[model samples]
Target: MTDTKNEQQWERTISFADGGTRLDKFWGRELADEGVSRGRVKAWIESGLAKVNGRVVDKGKYKLAAGEKTVIGAAEPEAGEGAPDPVRGRLDVLFEDAAMLMVCKPAGLTTHPAPGEPGPTLVNLLLHRWPDIAADKSGMDEQRPGIVHRLDKDTSGVMAVARTEAARLKLSADFAEHNVFKVYLALVHGVPTPAQGTVDAPMGRHPSQKTKMAVVDKGGREARSDYRVLWTGPRGLASLVAVRIHTGRTHQIRVHMAHIGHPLLGDAVYGPRESAEWERRPDLLAGLAPRQMLHAFYLSVFHPETGEPVTRWLPPPEDFCALLAGLPRECLRVGVVGMPGGGKSALMRFLGAMGRPCFSADECVAELYNPGGDGAAMINQRFGGAYTLEDGGVDKPGLFAAMRESDQVRREVNDMVHPMVRHRCEEFFKAHRDEPVAYAEVPLLLEGGWHKEGMVDLVAGVRCPADKRTGELRRLRNLPPEILAVFDSWQWPEKDKLAACDFVADNSAGLDHLEREAERLDAAALAALADRDRATEAWMDGLWPGLAGELDRERAGGEGPA
Candidate 1:
C-alpha cells in the first residue's frame, strides 16, 4: 500500500594510468562494482543510467588515466558482504536526537559505497558513534542498508538517516509521496527575466554528449521546477532561484535550466557551452568554477515518531557565492561585422538561423524613412512629381532629383541611417553576450576604416569578380558609362576589398563552393573560439581546491579543456 520500490547504488575505483583509458572503456578494466560488462559501460551512459560526478559519463573514447575515481551506476545499492569496521568520515552533524539524525554533507562525499568503501560513511560513523545503530541495521541491504535517498557528490546539503528501520520506511514514504518539501539555492549565470518562472523540460541523456542530458519532449520523464529571479549582470544574468521538483530525475535542475538556455554557474559538465554563451568556447568551462553551484538549502519534513514538522536551512556555500561574483565583463559582449555587401544581411540572417539576437540595418532605415515623413514625398519635394507614380510612390525621376538637390541632403540621409545601424549593431552584441561575431553590411568598409577599429572581431568579405558584378548591374540598368563609373568610384576596388579582408568568401563561385568557403570561414571562427576557450580555461585553472569527486583534478590536470 506504500511506496516500496527501492533503487540501489554502487561505487567503484578503476585503474587507468597504464596509458589512456576511456571513461566507458571497461574492455579490460574490472567493473567489479555491478558485475556490469565493460562493453555496456558505454551503453549505460547512452541510456541515461550512468553518471560520473553526477552528470552522465557518456564517452567510450575517454582514455582512462591513473588514479581516476569511478562510480558505478546501478538501480540499487549493493549488499555489503563483510562486517567491516566503521571508517570514520567527516560529517557535519546538523541535529542529532534519540529518535532521528540530520547531517550536512559536503561536496565530494558519496551517499554510499559503489564498492571498496574504506572510510566510515555516515551510517558507519553513526554505527561506530552509537552502538545501538547495529540494531537498526537488522533488515537493511548489506550496502547502504540505512541510506534512504541521495545527493550527487557535488551537491552539498542536509541529509537524514534513520536510526530505526520503521522510521526509515516512514521517512522514505514521506519522500515518495511528495510530503517532504526541499529547496535548493543555485547561482546561475544569467538572471531569469520576469523575476519568476518554471521550466517543465523532460530530461534524457544527450544523444552525442555522453556526460550531459538534453531536454527531450518524448521518451523522457516529466520534470517541473519553480524558480524566482535573483539578479542580473553584464556578463549575462545572476539569479537566486528557489527550485521545487516533482520528479527526481538525474540532473533535473541542471538539465532543465540548460535546456531553456541557462546553465548553472559552476556545473562544468552541463554548465559549459549549453547556456553559458560559450558553446563556441568548450574550454571556457574547463576549470572555471569549483563545482556545480547547486546547494540543498532548505528542507521540510514531518517527524516519524513525534509527528513534529521539521524544517532545516543552510546558507549558500562560500564557493557558490564566489562563482556568482566571478563572471567577467568582456565575456558578455557579442560583436557583428562584415565587409560591405559581404551579405552581412545574409550573415545576419545566418546569425538569426543560429539563434542570435538581431537587427537589420535596412529595416531600420525603412522605419526611419517612414517616421512622420514619406521618403519618396520628401525626395519628390526636392526633385518633383515627374518621378511619382499615380499611387504617390516616388518616381524614378524623383530619386535623381533628390540626389542632385544638394550633396548635404544626401549626406543627411546617410547620417540618419548609419548611426541607427551602429546603434542596433551594438545592441545585438550586448544582448548576445559577445558571441563568435555578428555581421554589419557596410558597403564602404574600407573607406570607413570600420574594420581597422571595432564593431567586429574579424573583417570578412563576400566577393564576385568585377565583370560578374558589372554584368549583374548591366542586367538591371544599362546606364551611361559615366553613371557606372561614378558608382564604381564610390566603392573600393575588388583587389583592395580582398586584401583588406580578414576572411574572404568568393560568392562568384557556385553555391557548393560558397558553402565550402563558408565552412572554411566557420573553421576559422571555431579556431578563434577555441583559442578564447583555452584562455578562459587557463584563467580559471586551479580555481576549485577540494573537489576530488571519485577522482581528483590534479591527477587529471590539463586533461579536460586546454
Candidate 2:
C-alpha cells in the first residue's frame, strides 16, 4: 500500500495481499519519506482526518481489506528560521482584554504566514495591532505566535487571539478539549429536511484530491454538525442555514453539507458545477461569488483568565447578503395521487431516496389505528362496538365486511379518517417549510378534491396496466377481486387522472423502468420550481425596475439594504 516515491502526498489502493494490515502502520510506512511519524499518523486517524474507500475511519488499528483505498494528507513542512513580516490591514476587534482579544476575520484572509510565502495575513494584522503578539510564542509555529485554532483561509468570522503566553497556553488547551462553541451561517443550494438535524458522519482527506476532504469510513475521526434551516429561497432554490459544529474537522461543514446533497451555494469545490440548475440558469450562476457561501458568524469560548464564557456574533459580509437578496423565495410542495396497486408507495420511496420529504397517507392511517389509538374508540362509538375485537382493537376484517354490506359504512369511515389525515399532512408541510421539495402520497387525492383545495403545487399520477395491477393485487396482497373492483370504482378514470396530473409515471413495467420515469419527473419538477422562481423575480423587477440594482449598490457601499 505504501507509495514511497511520492511520500509527501499519495493515495494507495489495497490489494488482496495487503489486506488485514493496520491503517496507521500501512500509511506510516507509505509516507516515511515525508518524515511522517507513526504518532502523527495515529493523531490524524483519531482526528477523523484519514479515509478508506472514500469514508472516514476513526480507528488507527482498523484492518485494511482488499479493493479498499486510503488517502494520506501529510502535514505541512516546518518553516525555516526568518523574521515574520508584518503587514497593515483592517481588523474588526469585537472584544479585548489583557489576556486575549476577539476579532472578526474576513473572508479571503489567511490565518498565518506559510513557509517561504510572505504575504499579508491575519497574523500580520494582529502584529500590527498588538506588537507583543509576535513575542508570545505559545503556539506550535513561531509565525502563528498567539493563534490557537484557525479557520480555513476563505472562511470568515469570530476568531480569538491570545496576547500573553499564559493566555495562549490556556486557550490552546481549551480548544484541544473541544470547549469552544462555533456557529456558522451558510447559503446552500437546497434546504435540508426536518428543518433541523445533525450530520454525524466522520471526515477525512479526500482519497484522490489532496486539497479536498471527504466523509470516509476508515482511519477517520468523529465529526458532527448540527444545522437548522433559518430561511428558504423562492421555489426552494436556496436556503439560509445556521450550523453549529461539535468537532473542528477540516472542511467538516462543506463535506457534510455536500454529503447530504445540499452543498453550499458558490462552493466550487464541493458543489456540483454541471447540475441542471446551473446549466439552465448561467446568469444566476454568474452572479455567485468566487468563494463558498460560508460564514463563521458566531463563537463562544471561555475567557482565558476570567474563566467566564464570552460569546460574539457578527453579521454576514456584504457579498453574502447581496447574493441572497437577488435569489427567489418560494418553496416546493408536490402531491402524489394514484389508485390502489398503482405503485404510489413505490413512487414515494423513489422520491424520498432523491432527498425529497415524503409522507404516506397509509402510514398516517396505520398510526391512527395502532394499539391504544383514538381511531379505534371513534370507530366503536360510531358502529356501537360491532367492529371492535376481543383485544379492544378495531377489527379490520369486520369493518371491511361492513363496508361490503353498505356503501354508507365506507363513507362514514372516510369521513372519520380523511380529515385527520389531511390535518396531519398539513402539519407535516408546515414543519418542513424550509425543504426545497416535499411529497405526500394521497391515494384519494383527486377523489377527495384535495387538488382543487389548493393544498399542493403539483399532482403526480402513477399508472399501472389493468392485468398487471390485478396480478399484483392477487399475488402480493391477496386482495379479493370484489374489493379491488370497489377500490377501482372509487378512483377517477386512469386517463382522466393522467390528464389532470402535472406528470405521470408508468409502473406497468419493471421497477428499473419505473425508476427511470421517476427520475425524469423529478427533474421536471425541479425545472418547474426554477421557472416559478424566475417568474417571481420578473414580477418583482416589473414592480420596481431598478430596485435590485439600488440594493446591490447599497450593500457594496457598506450599508445593508432596508
Candidate 3:
C-alpha cells in the first residue's frame, strides 16, 4: 500500500493459488491487515477505483486471472465546495474506529451550522480534528459532512458520525430504515399516568410559527415515542422520565411530550407557562433550569464497517444533576433509641465518623437551654420568672424538681421543650438533604411518643447485657441503685423496645464490635434508602425485573448483620 497526499494506492499481482478468486474478495483478503471490509472494497471497485492489467474493471464480481496486476486506489478525504471550516475547540470523543466516530456533544453546541445560526458547531470541531471526514459528503446535507444524525443545540448526549464515504452511506441507510436505537432522559412537569405508554403522532412545522415544530393533523411525518416514568418529585412537582424514539423527527420528543400535557421542564418553546407558576414553589427545581431538560442518554447502531453492534451511554450533565439535587427528596432517617447506658451515643458517633449526619435530641435540648434560646424564652414567658436563671436561661434542675412536684408543670415543660427539639431536627434534615442517610440519638424516642410521629424513616433499638448497662450507669453517673430502678421504670422493657424497632443491634459486645455494627447499619440504611428511591427502583426494574426480590430473599435467608 502506498499513501499519497490525495489518495491511497495498493498494488498486487494475482497468484495461481488465488487465480479464481473474485476481485473484491482478493482485495479484501490482501487488505485485511488494513481493516478494509469486503463491502467497502466492492464499492471502491464499482466506483472505477480498481483496475486490472492497466484497464479499469468496475465489476467487483470480475474473476481474477493469475499474473494480472491489479491496483485499488481510494482518495483521501479533502475539503470540498461549501464544506464546513475547521474550528479548534474542545471535543469529547467517546469512541472512535476506522468507520465511525462516537462523540459526547455538550449542551449549547450546535450539531451543524445552518442559516442564521452560528459556526464552531460539532461539525467544525470534527473537521478540525478528524480532517479526513471533510470530503465524505455522502450525508443528506452536503454541508454536514460525516454527520449521520443530529441533536438540538441545547440538548446533550452521545452521537455517531461516519468517517468514510462507505461508512456514511451505510449509516445513513441504517438511520433512514430506523435500525438505530435511541433512548433519551428528561425531566418533565408531572409524572405521566399509567407509568408507561406510547405516543404515536404526526409532526410538522407549526402553522403560525415558522421556526417551531408541533403535532400536526395533516401532511405531517410519522413519529412515535415510548416513555416510562422513572420517578416523580415530591408533591408531583416534577418527574424524571425515559423516552425511546422509534422514528426520528425534528423536536419529536418535545412536541410529543407537550402534546400529552407533560411538557419537559425548561422547554420554553413548547412548554406551558409553568415556570412562572413554579416560582411560587421554593422547594421545586423547575424554576432553576437554564434550558430544556432533555438528554440523549443512550444510542446503539450497527458498525458501519464490521457490522457488529456499537453502543454508547452518557451520564447526566452537571446542570442536569444540579437540578436533580435541587429536587426534594427524603434521606434515610434512622432514630437510635435505648436505655441511657446502652451505647446509643456511641453508635451515633460511629455513624458520624463514617460520614453520615448524626443528630442528638439531648444535644439539641442543651442548645435550647442556652441563654436567650427559644426554649428558655418560652419557659420564662410561661412560668412568670419562677424557672428563669440569672443568664435568662431555663433553670433545668429547678424545673425538673418542680415538675416532679406537679404533673401540670411537667406537662407544660414537655410541651415547651419538645417542639423546640423537633424544630432543630427538622433543620438538620434540611441542611443535609443531599446525604444518603442520617442518624438521630433520641433516648426517649418511644417514651415521648415521637417514635409514632413519623419523624424518622427507621427505628433502631440498641440493647446491652443487663449487667453491662447497670455497670455503665453506676460508673458514669454514680447513680444510686434506687435511681437506676426509677430510670428503668420510666421506659419500656428491653424486650418490648426491641419488638418496637424495625431492626436491632446488640451492644453486649465491646465498642469494637459496636463499631462494626455501625458499619453494618450504614450499609443497611443506605440499601434501604436506595430501595425507596423511586428512580433507582424503576431503573432496577427496567434492567433486571424480579432481581431485587431474589436478592431480598437471599439476604433474608442469610445470616443477620455481624
Predicted structure with the largest lDDT when compared to the true one: 3
lDDT of candidate 2 over 26-52, digit per residue (tens) = 888765534568888888788766766
Candidate order, lDDT descending: 3, 2, 1
Question: Each model's TM-score, in the order given?
Answer: 0.46, 0.49, 0.50
lDDT of 3 by residue, 61-126 (tens): 899875455678674222244456799999888789888989999999999755445567898898
lDDT pick, better of 2 and 3: 3
| lDDT by residue for model 1 (1-562), tens | 0111234444432322333656665532434323456666656656555543233455666664332234545452222334335656566777777656777877766665444334445556665665555533444434444455678778888777766656666665565445566667676767676577888877665666744567865555457787765445433545556576655566888887766666786676776564445333333332446677788766656777887766556655667654544443233222333333333455455545555455565565555445233554564465465445666664444554565566785576455446666666666555554455444555654665656565556666777665655565345555655555554655677687777777776666555665666566666766766676666455434322212121223223523211
523, model 1: CA deviation in Å? 47
Ten-residue stretch with the least lDDT total in model 3: 553-562
Model 1 regions lying over 4 Å from their true place? 1-85, 115-131, 134-138, 204-214, 274-288, 327-562
TM-score of 1: 0.46
Clash tally, candidates in order: 35, 16, 0
